[model samples]
Target: MSTVLIVAEHLNGRLNAATARCVSAAAALSPAAIDIVVLAADAATIAAQAAQIAGVRKVLAVANPANAHAIAQVQAPQVAALAGGYSHVFGPSTTFGKDLMPAVAALLGVDQVSDLMAVEGSHSFKRPIYAGNAIITVEMPAGSQVVATVRTASWPEAAAGGSATVEAASVDATLPSHTRFIGLASASSDRPDLQSARRVVSGGRGVGSEDNFKIIYHLADRLGAAVGASRAAVDAGYVPSDLQVGQTGKIIAPELYIAVGISGAIQHLTGIKDAGTIVAINKDGDAPIFEIADIGLVGDLFQVLPELEQALG
Candidate 1:
């Protein structure tokens, strides 16, 4: 049996939900021994946490102060080298993961599978192409290990079990640098992270203004949902770019997704196509959002949102 190396992602000491999702994807590829590699400024703490993830056979820790922050240059080679012994390497399709995996693949002298949706077999994989309008099946070439970044919504998160053993590994601190962090300008919010949330509430041009976005926020709060936006809404300055969900933005697969006042475009739907239950609310009954929506509401969003919030509350 071959081993699969999963790179654990973290911020501060908390494990990113994507890491658990990766483990779930790894399980689908093979039930073979799954090992999690943690690169942290403090290895002991991260290792302790990683050991609890279900299905993890071993936790490998590499503590280098330079690795405390998630930078591609800091972790790429370390992950590449650590992944050397495994038959496959898997990570999340996050910006950090996408940046780091290419370097790791380069070090392994193989092109990565990149954003795989399904693993058909040990060597064959399926992925989206042309902005998710088509699916492409690929077979890994000879002499190269399987490398892929799983889309977050494509897999369910595994539960964390009791403790497991951790081992220490040495990594070279010196690697190539492309970009340096200045400061993080994260949006201030209590909402869930869009890509990983179980429920999502999205707004669009019909939202009218930045001020009216509060209605969507209230609805999201009542439903315990992460907030998302259409590209037009983000471009119109009603929301941040990060909140945009589409082929060009973040892809999400929530259990429930509500699109408010959004006239869904093909690009926007691509990011949310995997959502389990889709609800669309738009005054224009013919809006494309209704085409994919499980439930469609034709009404003014201003009136509908307050009523929905009241009912939920």
Candidate 2:
């Protein structure tokens, strides 16, 4: 009889793949009703996308001009307003959820369960701590609302082809004016999104310079993978910070992850620990990344990359 509501993540007018993964995580709680809340200026378009996520029973769209930017300050209160009648409220453990869910938990007067990796039961769950080094089991207080962030990396995206109902959800809360949407700036790439890409190719300080990083991109494009970078590479001005992958940057779990010239810092390894098949190519055979890599090739990237591109072609 428990009901769960997921806060959908979207951009422009489309749902994020993470939202479907949240639905897949919610479906593990059999017999529980799963619903999604879409908060946007034009929610109908996104709501329709959410409704198509299998395992969802309903989609609630809260359309408002203030919602166009997805500022956590503005959306937290709205999420809290919609938390009623639901025993649990969930969001993806991305930057969006990390910023917003804690506030929702505070408003609900409950401790938030972050990075939920497994649903042991409705109230019992498992999550990671110490940079995913340890997983601990937690139990939500009985009779209290459970607010959690689903770690999209640990679960699979929910399949499409659902026929859930989409309805307009009311938000009667006062809007906060202090938090305003300013102009936004970010790197644009035609390559797959780093976080959701099934295959990824990353570079590090070994890439030498920004121009040399093109070798990494060429290999990535040949493999149809996204481009990623180590913090060192980003700090060295070899790539944009958005491409950095490490404990401090974006965490991803692609099926095939290729590390070219990356020395495999522990911080960097944390980000890709969940990746399915890790292939490390470094000049140093003693590099720590080789210890966990399914395939390790010790060689000079500049020489090896061209050969790979030709072979793949």
Cα-based lDDT for every prediction? 0.86, 0.90
Q: Residue 17 error for model 2, in Å?
A: 0.6
lDDT of 1 by residue, 1-313 (tens): 5579999888768778898889888888665799999998898887888889888888999988778788887688789777768989998998778888888888888878888888787878888988888899989975468878888777888888846679998965356666655577677777788878999999999999999999999888888999999999999999989999999889999999999989999999999999999999999999898999999999999898888878875
Give the alpha carbon lDDT tens digit for every residue of 274-294 in model 2.
899999999999999999999
Best candidate, lDDT: 2
Candidate 2 Cα outliers beyond 4 Å, as residue runs = none
Q: How well does candidate 1 score on lDDT at residue 261?
A: 88
Query: What TM-score, over all chains together, does every model reach?
Result: 0.95, 0.96
- Steric clash pairs (candidate 1): none
Worst 10 residues of 2 by lDDT: 23-32
